[model samples]
Target: MDWERFARQMATMAHDLLEQDSVVGTLERIVRSATELVHGCDAAGILLMDGGRVRTLAATEPMVDASDRLQERLQEGPCFDAARLRDGERVYRIENMTVLQQRWPAYAPSARELGIGSMMGFLLFTENENLGALNLYSRLPGRFTETSETAAWVLASHAAVALSSARSHAQMTESVATRHVIGEAMGILMAGHHIAEDTAFNMLRRHSQDRNVKLREVAREVVELGALPRPEQPSRQ
Candidate 1:
């Protein structure tokens, strides 16, 4: 390994990932970089899971998209396992997909049929959360070397931090927007009903609970229509 060149490349990759402005962009770049920067990786994708459902945020090829969908449908594969990583396990490597039929019964056969010969998946995680997996695919069996794994792991580490930061930024932006809408709704209610701030907030809260909706949604309605949606109460028999 060229330690000096590797260090320079790692620094460059970290800078590029951190500078990404959106989660989607960051994910796209991760997969794109995987194919470009990782040895023997012919295609790549980012598989994000929300509970049991999986979505491919980005991929280098249509084959990768199809592969992820198969994994989602079967609920079995290295990518799925990597996303829901067990304790002390952060990466999964299928050195020869053609021979691992039993390990991923449903996914392996189909993946092999699709010409995927090997796979490597790394969990995208923070200290508190498991975000997903960064998956690499190769069309030749046993294509990934120890060096390839080490380099890809380093990239995945940087990607996880960048992904977490992107999501945090997005959540903060949404939170600020929600607060603005809620404030506007509160102002409307206070002006229309001549109520105090606490009273207006209580009204919104009560409506949100009664409608079985989120506080943000209730606030959004008030902001758009300038009125609360009050469902009719049932009469006592």
Candidate 2:
């Protein structure tokens, strides 16, 4: 490996990750960078454990998704362990999936059949939160080396920070937009019904709770309809 060139590339990747417009874009860039920068990495993806179910994100190839599904079905794999934060390790590498008859016995052979000869998983985490696992896949046995693992570790570190930043920014933007919409709705209600601002807001909140809908959705309905809809009443039997 050209250490100098690799370092420069990693720097570029870090900048690119921060520049992504959304959380989804940041995740896509993270996986794409893995295939480009990690030696012997043929495909890559992120696996998120959502309510005990596997959610695969930004898969670079069908093989990546297939590997994730295999792990999800069998309930074990290096990526699964990394995402679930099991065994207290943030990084896992299977140097030879074809021969690994242990430590994921059910998953190794299936992964091999999916053209995954070796795999590496890095837990994307920060001080406050764990984002997910970034998984790299190769098509040839013994493809990943110690150097490859080092490269991926650095990439994962940068990826975690970038993903967190992206999500925060997106949330801030959405919050601002929601506030604007709600304010508009309140203003419309106050003008139409000659009610105070607090009363208008309370009405919206009551509607939201009664309908079991988001406050933003209720507010949007007020803005669009120029008035609050009547609450649904219980129907007589």
The model with the greatest TM-score is 2
TM-score of each: 0.88, 0.94
Poorest lDDT segment (10 consecutive residues) of candidate 1 = 124-133
* Candidate 1 C-alpha lDDT tens digits along 1-237: 786788787788788888888888888888888887788999999887777788888898899989888888888888888888755589888888778466777888889988999999898873444358899999999999899999899989888888889889999999999999889999999999999999999999999998899998999999888899768789999
Per-residue lDDT, model 1, residue 117, is 94
The per-model lDDT (C-alpha) reads: 0.87, 0.89
lDDT of 1 at 98: 70
For residues 12-40, what per-residue lDDT tens digits would candidate 2 score against the true structure?
Answer: 99999998998999999999999999999
lDDT of 1: 0.87
Model 1's C-alpha root-mean-square deviation from the true structure amounts to: 2.9
Relative to the true structure, candidate 1 reaches a TM of: 0.88
Highest lDDT, which number? 2
Give me the runs in candidate 1 sitting further than 4 Å from their true place: 100-102, 126-131, 230-237
Error of 1 at 194 (Å): 1.8
